[model samples]
Target: MTTTPNPTLIYPPKPSILFTNIHFYISHKPFTSSSSPKSNSFTIKCSGNASSDPKNSDGGLKNLLSGIVDERVDELLNREENRVLLDGLDKATQRVEIAKRELAQIEQQELENKKMKEYINQLEIRAAEIEECQKELLEARTLVDEAERSLEVEIEDKNSTMTETEREEMYKNKERFESVKAASVSAIVGTLAGLPISLTQAANTSQLILPSVITLISCALFGVTFRYAVRRDLDNFQLKTGTSAAFAFVKGLATLGGGPPMELEVGSISSHAFTGAVYISENLLIFLFAAVGLDFCIKLRILSPFPIETDVSTTKVD
Candidate 1:
């Protein structure tokens, strides 16, 4: 019973048909592993067949090597495609960041431009205010100048009125003084006229003739001095008042009435009449006549007149 053959231990010769079938199977379907099928599948097939037959092993090994090379090339190509995709993603992200930065910069520039525009507007408003203020200042100055001119005109008018009033008051005072002087002169003339011719004759022949002659001469001298004083006072008043007409009128009236005349009354009358005629003919000559006449009267009063005997002796032949 132990003499039956163990089929598992029996070694049979490899058949050509079996080797050819194995080669066909290896060529069509190389050994595949779950973990790394592309790299290990061809290597397993080549190693398994190399031990089976020498002639078939060489061809199988060559084909397995070619398949392994192709698998390695495919793995390299897949790795390259993944790397390109990652790089593209990174570039896209960088472009997006750059766009965001550009947008922020543009926004900042816009904000700055808005601020500058507002500042320019404020400056323009301030300039307008300054112009308005300047206009107001000029207007105020013009008004002040007009007010000053009006005040000056008012002051001039007031001064003119005051001067007119003073002139009127001076004229009134002068008229009153002339009236009093005329009344005094008339009273003196009336007192001299009351003396009788018989009394004058008795006084000339008697011992009292010297005293009477002296008294008459003194009276005549006093009358002449008083008349000249009144005329000089009136003339000075007229000169101060710049009224030559007033002085000329007083002189003409006094001369016609013979108030300041003694024995040479006709000469006095003729001279005064000539001066009055000259003053009436040309009013501009009044000032000169009044001045000369007033000066002559003052000089006549200052210098004593020569006695009648001396005058007669001088006229007679020595």
Candidate 2:
């Protein structure tokens, strides 16, 4: 060869072709001596589908590797231990999520407890203020009660001093009035008693004067006696009746003894008894009239019901 033959270039297999499922078979033989010089030859055979196109070979190799890897993963997952490990991993993830939720709830509970404590503290403060207000009210009430009692005592003392002067003034007026009333009543009643006797002796005016004077004096004295007698707390009707009767009987006895002279006669005892009865009966009617007049005056409120001294003394006790 004058010029070196052009060098042949052979490229290596692509990565995809290397991973493809391909099988190769090779056979070698030596030539026999009778035929020619010794020489060796090979028969090459390939198994499985191998593409000649580069793009197709790469795609087919990629598909074949993907399928084999999937089969191997399936076989590994089909084992019981591997299945249990996967299940355990899923459960662990769920437990982590649950723990995060519980932590959030715990934080919320703490916040609620803080709020409750603050509310309770406010209530305690309010209760203390109420107690203090109650204590102040009680003290104020105590002061008011003491002031009222003191005012009452002062009023009572003033009244006691003032009443003494009032009583003295009242008693003086009553004494003057009572004396005048008693004298006026006695004078009028005495004049009425003398009128009947004076008319009988109307012929001699000088003779009428003595009897009239005597009757007037006796009636005046009787009024004084009556006033003293009734001063005692006794029944009005009984006292008036008894006083009138006694005065009438005394006047009758006096008239009987001091009458014109009479000679002794038969049946003198009966005559004296009858004459005494007649004189007593006449005087009794006049005294009874005076008693009734005084009682009427009392009922009409013209006279005081109680004795002057006794009434004044009993006022303070009442």
Candidate 3:
């Protein structure tokens, strides 16, 4: 095998450079020495023969083959063609900076327009909410009006008195009540006076239908008679006790000026009516005897009171 010798390596001299800062500025920030990012220093680095070194033929030969010298590079910088190319490059850089600034302004305008559109949408939503609230308010007002009308109609019906058509039924009930009451009184009086068992008592003992018949008959007569009263007596009483109280309460609501009295007459009326009815039902014969006793006292002039007016025309509006 044969070995070949390695060629000797040669190195050219390294270049020297000079820098001249054309426009350098110092910032006013405290204790900061930060340099600008843009390089404004003119570089004059070239492999030229201006070095003060010892003459060496081998080094000169290496530099000849390496590159151009510093003098030639300076001459190229001053050439007309190179100067025009540099001017063109500088103009292009300026145009690029203007384009970047315009792009930033356009982005800012687009962001502002987007924010305005969002604000407009919010305003529209608020308007819609306000309109909905107004509609609800109008609906509530309409409902309140309807309620007032219904309440007024109910008040008129409750405060009004009996009509002419109801008087015929009232008279019939009055006739039935008078007949039954008279018979009951007579039967009780006779029994208490030691008279013989009457037909009514006899029927009640034999068949249990007499008492039931009397109860139903009295209820039918009194129920009809009490619906519309010509008088506030036992035969004609306020059956709708709660409703009458409610009517009076509604009338007494206006208490500022001359409103009606706040006294609840229904309590007194209901106490007398239901209590009297219950007392009679406990023992009809005893109730009749009591009535006879009261009548005897009154007829003997031992008891006298104010006269009661029961005619339909005698009713007062208040």
Candidate 4:
């Protein structure tokens, strides 16, 4: 029996091919008695261009390696273990970027704070300067007020001086009238007192006229002096008495030296010393009468008091 020759199965040799931009996916399983051999074998899948030229093979091989590397990287990323590791790496990178951004923001905030602090310091300095300037202004204002007050006082003093001068000029006529009134009162008193005595002792009318005129003139002079001496005194007995006695003594001296001679009377003293005593005593009586009348007139507001006392009081008030 010619058995059919066992079929001679021969495999042809594969030609070398260069691949460019090719991707390959490979898988394998452990061989086991229950599994098919095909299931345990490695598998390869390829895509992209293939060439047999040696010159073109290098570039294609390089492209194939590059594509294979990219495919392997994609596979690794898809796998569970490798994907977890890549995810951890990506999260760590994101954290690093976020940290950098936060650091930049913190630095900017610190710079802004520094600028704000500087501005505040400048404002404080300006406020202090303003306070100092205000104090200086207040002091200047106080000085100006004092100057104005002093000027006002000076002007018032000048005005018051002018007023005093005008018052003195106006009162001159009044002073003269007072003098005339006092002198006339004294002359009348003297003539009345001396006429009787002169008539009693005179040798003739000629002697009477001389003694009477002399007495009248002397008493008039005394009255003017008395009015000034006791200008406003109405009730001072001592001043009035002293003034009368002084006038009487002066009149007696004048009569003894140059007065008209008196004729002797019956049953009367005739010595020169006795005659002098009579002259003094008679003048004293005449002065007493004049003083009483003048004092009465002063009390009745017939004359003004001296102006010197009023002027001194007004000056004290100013």
Candidate 5:
């Protein structure tokens, strides 16, 4: 009796008690028994949440990863912005260079146009000057031509007047010469007519008549004497006797007749009668002939005409 002391009745402990204890035990035991396993599971879940949430692992490790990702994103954004800015800057520089080049080209074109216009203006001015010079030259040539023509006309008129004057002088000279010749011939005839008479006689009573008759007789005697002398000389020399004989016959006929045929031989008389006649007649006659010849020489020289020459220069006109 004491032994199993109501093992059953002992209530093995009251059932509530047992259940409560069991519950306590079970709760406590599960906590104790699988504490390590549960801790491992909880750890795994926490790791998974942490990994999935991308929130935290080691504090330094989380910080490093966050910093690396942030730095990479910043680098990409900065690189893109820098590229855009560089492109903008390059485009602006190119535009500036193009503007500079265009400005230089416009300046160069303006300079060239200015130079061309200046050259054209100079050429036009030169052309006008050349035309004016040509006109002046033509005018000068025309003036020269006119002057030459006037000079030529004047020279011609002067030459004509001189020629007319010379012709008139020549005509006057010819007339004077003719008159002088007539006078000389008359003087000679008068001398010959008086020669024989002056030599024939010296009688005071018949002085006048004697002189006239003696002049005629002396002329006849001189003619006969000259004929005889020529014939004698021809015969003595055996030279051309025909002329001498003819002269002698004419002299003989003159001596037989009383005519003027014997008067031609008045220069040949040498007898006293003939010489006296010659002295009275030929002395004055010779003086007269000499005077007439001298006058003729002087007058001819005075009346002679000379030639004149004229020269003129001329220019051509257009």
Candidate 6:
């Protein structure tokens, strides 16, 4: 009797393929048992049809191999191995961060170096300016030294030939000449001071402010010159001072007499005589003034008619 082959039961299969130089197939098991059961999927190495190999077992051998391969893959992906790989990656990232910070510091240092270089350049320029000023000061000092030397040499040449007595006489004569010149100048200045007063006094009454102001200005000029002349002999200075005072005093009468009122009242001849008298009296007063003050200064030991200087330590250079 021909027995009918048991009805082949086929279930839908899940298949997976892997390709490289060779291909692998992963297949889900076929269910043929009357008892309902899920089949395990297994990886199979294949060149051609799986039915050709009698050694290829249905599920047992392939399931065992797939289980071993899956366990090995899971071990590779475990927490310890993954954590070690993550640590290595973190270390590389930290290295990159450190390099970036170092690069920034280096750039900052370079900028600071550039600023320092510029500051150094400015300091060098200022130093050069100071050096130039020092050089100029030294040059000016040398020139002044040379000029003082020349002046001393000239003074020495003038004084060398004269005896002490002769030098004294010469100084006295020079003093006399300077005194007379000073007295004459003072008299002229006094006369100028009085002229405005004289002119305005006769034009009805007028303020004396103009004459006073003129005298003040003239005295200022003379005072400045006199102070500059103080290094000269004390007797000469006293003579000049006394002459100035006396001239200012003696010119008062002339100024009063020469007013417009007097000019109108008196004849030209009377005016001429008055002018002559005033001029003569003014001169006499200046001489008397100089003699009195000179004597006073001498008595006080503030002046000397004959001052003696001796001892020449260094020869004057020409």
lDDT of 6 by residue, 201-282 (tens): 5454455555545454444344333423433455475656554555455454555455544444458658756766665455
lDDT of 5 by residue, 155-273 (tens): 77875666545655655565455444433443344345444444554456466664444334433333333233332232233332333244334433343344233343545333434
Candidate 5, which segments miss by more than 4 Å at Cα? 1-81, 164-318
Q: Count residue pairs with overlapping backbones in model 6.
A: 0
Question: Tens digits of per-residue lDDT for model 3 on 1-318?
Answer: 122223452443533323223233323332234665333333332333335464663476467534544545666668777778779999999999999999999999999999999999999999999999999999999999999999999966754655655654565565555445544443444334322223444555546444445433443333232222322333222423332333223322221124233346888666555544443333343333334443453355432211222443343322
lDDT of each candidate versus the true structure: 0.49, 0.67, 0.47, 0.73, 0.46, 0.53
Candidate 2 per-residue lDDT over residues 1-318, each given as its tens digit: 011222352442421122322432211112122544443343323234346677986786588658865975776677677778879999999999999999999999999999999999999999999999999999999999999999999977875767666867777788667655654566467558657856775678788777667666666666656666776443667888898889889987787778754558757766777788877876677666666665566567675533666656676454
- Residues 61-171 of candidate 1: C-alpha lDDT, one tens digit per residue: 588669866986566546755567668999999999999999999999999999999999999999999999999999999999999999999976874566545645655
Where does model 3 exceed 4 Å of error?
1-68, 161-318
Better of 2 and 3 by TM-score: 2
TM-score of each: 0.28, 0.41, 0.30, 0.43, 0.28, 0.33
* Residue 17's lDDT in candidate 6: 25
Better of 1 and 6 by TM-score: 6
Error of 5 at 147 (Å): 0.9
User: Which candidate has the highest TM-score of all?
Assistant: 4
For residue 123, model 2's alpha carbon misses the true position, in angstroms, by 63
Which has the better lDDT: candidate 1, or candidate 3?
A: 1
What is candidate 4's lDDT per residue for 56-140, written digit by digit as tens? 8677658867886697667656777666777899999999999999999999999999999999999999999999999999999
Cα error, residue 275 of model 3, in Å, equals 60
